[model samples]
Target: MSFGPFLLLALLEGTVMAAVLALTAVGLSLVFGVMRVVNVAHGEFFMLGAVGAWFITYYLPLPPGLAWLVALIIAPLVVGAIAALADVTILKRLKYDPEATIVATIGLLYILQQAALTFYGPDARPVEPPFSLRLQFPWFGYSGYKLFVVAAAGAILLAVWLFMTRTKAGLVMRATQVDMETARAFGINVDRVYAGTFALGAALAAAAAVLIVPIQQAHYLMGHDPLLLSFIVVIIGGLGSIRGTLIAALLIGLSDGVISMFFSPTLAKIIATLLVAMVLVFRPQGLFGARA
Candidate 1:
């Protein structure tokens, strides 16, 4: 076994996997931090975004890159709209009932899943990289498109961080997350904040799905792995902290990549899950979480 190839593969997977983890977990963090609602249908939104992007790119005679771009931009907006509608119509009504919020999202998850199945069937559909850019990276060669995804995900994450830290909207979001009543008292429209935050979280999930579709393909149930992974990340990172989520995501991504490189992927996943379980038992606030 050539250690060099395995090392390279591990590095590649770690990098991209971290991006995926960040994308998926950030949304979960946002929802938890601000709205205090767990969206069971988050994965379904990811699937919806991927499928929606695929259709636009494939059926519209657009260039492959353009198609993916369309998916990247449009899918998130569409999913965000759906989320906003749900927030206004359902979640808002049950603001005081956390259990009801969970149940409602679970119901939405099933509806979205069934709708995806009915439209795309049960088979997994592969989506090709928009263009062939044979980029040589000194030792590790990769398709130009995968490189694009890596770059795009990184840029998006940076943008999100900036938005959260620098923008007025970000301040408002933080205020809402910390205390809705206080934010409302301060003249911020709490309802608007909740709706916008929910939409933003949904959009983030959708955007991640768009980025991942080329590698994972468009499947009705494609969101399952991401959703599960996101939950694990949030738990490991501390429920509502973006810094914690980012750190834990990197930890999990690197751990999974190295484990898979050394052992079978299946076994690696099992080990990862065990590690998470142990972490939860020992450090319920997460590795990066502040001790409450």
Candidate 2:
């Protein structure tokens, strides 16, 4: 392929990757933003979603599209519930102490991972796309479903932004983030808020997983990259800045796609690491995070 065609393909792949990353990372950002908890298990939630999607599509008698649609709706809910349960049983009991929660979530991560391995097995499984339409480019044909994935992610992100900015529930979450004591003084249930926040974060990861599982595959250990990339995005975009997360995700995604296409995937990752180091040294607050 010529440079133009290759570059176009790279850009397309990068956009898809970015959409998934933003979806997953935003959840992490939300959890830290509101509850001040670092969830090491966030990636496990993503893996769970992929696993859940596989289960749903595999067992259901419906057509591929219908089964995929069902998986999209159900997997995230299941992951969210699991997260809420963990919050109530583990993190809450630890009093949401930052250090303790980190350790607690590390355990949570192992527990979820092992459970997936035990039951879901070690093999990677693919979920067929709901629709298989291909869009014809001048030089190539591209997945219509991939474009839909991008649109779906964009819609979900927009909805999340609206929820945070427009809804009363969002107001409560924001208030809690701003000041837990003040929010509680005004009658917010801090404990419930934390639990819900954690669940929401996990659900977002699951949703992202479900969307991408068709392009990729469901595997027990698939959470590692999403976790690492999401953390990098959170750090670079700012701790709680949604806008920053989106922008950083785009930057990383495009760079990864183009670089990986032009050079090598390992080199792309190394560049990303170097970018993070630069961001840390030059702008410790992150490009979008508020100054501490």
Candidate 3:
């Protein structure tokens, strides 16, 4: 491939990375925005989704496409249910105290990790793509599934946007986010909103995992990098701004891709970490976040 083609390849790969990162970070951002809860275990939920997908597609008698479709639906539901349970059992009990919930979620992270290690074992496994088709460009061939990932992610994001902007449920969540006491005064069921928000966040992460698992293998430790990267993205994009999340994901993703292609993955990550530090120091509210 020529320099132009290679650049094109990097852009495509970057788009894929951005898609996954946006999906994951949006969930993290949403949780923080609405519940004011930092879910340290969010990445573990993502890992669970990948593991669940593998098991589902592996055991189901359906064909690859059908099995993947099934996995896509089931894994997120399972993970979201688990998140909801966690919120009800752990977070609610603590009354969603920021410090307490942080500690609780950290504990949840280890528990989930240990559980996965015990049950799923220590092997990295991949779920096969729903379909395998390549796009033949004049320069080179590219993954059609990757392109599909971008499209799917865009669709999901659009749906989420619509839900938040248009639905009554979304209005309730937004109201809760703005003022918990006022929302409660209005009989909005604050606890229920928190639980639902947590579940929705986990569901988004799981869906993202299911989409990307075909490209990346599933392992108990697979959550670590995504966790870090998602945090970075959330921080840089602004704490609760969906639009900011999307923009930051694209910037970080494309930079990571181009930098990694030219330099090294470690360097790319280091750069991202530095960017996070800079954002925290200079603009803690983030690019899109409003000053509190």
lDDT of 3 by residue, 1-292 (tens): 6788888888889889999999999999999999999899999999999999999999999999999999989999999999999999999999889999999999999999999999999999988999999999998888899999999988998999999999999999999999999999999998899999999999999999999999998999999988999999999988888888889999888888888887899999998999899999999988777886
Alpha-carbon lDDT of model 3:
0.93
**Model 2 regions more than 4 Å off:** none
Reference-based TM-score, model 3? 0.98
Tens-digit lDDT string for candidate 2 (100-209): 99998999899999999999999999999998998999899999999999999999999999999999989999999999999999999999988888988999999999
By TM-score, rank the candidates, best first: 3, 2, 1
Query: What's the lDDT for candidate 2?
Result: 0.93
- lDDT leader: 2
| Superior by lDDT: candidate 1 or candidate 3 | 3
Local lDDT at 115 for model 3: 96
Off by over 4 Å in 1: 137-140
Clashing pairs in 2: none
lDDT per model vs. reference: 0.84, 0.93, 0.93
List residue ranges in candidate 3 displaced over 4 A.
Answer: none
TM-scores of all predicted structures: 0.94, 0.97, 0.98
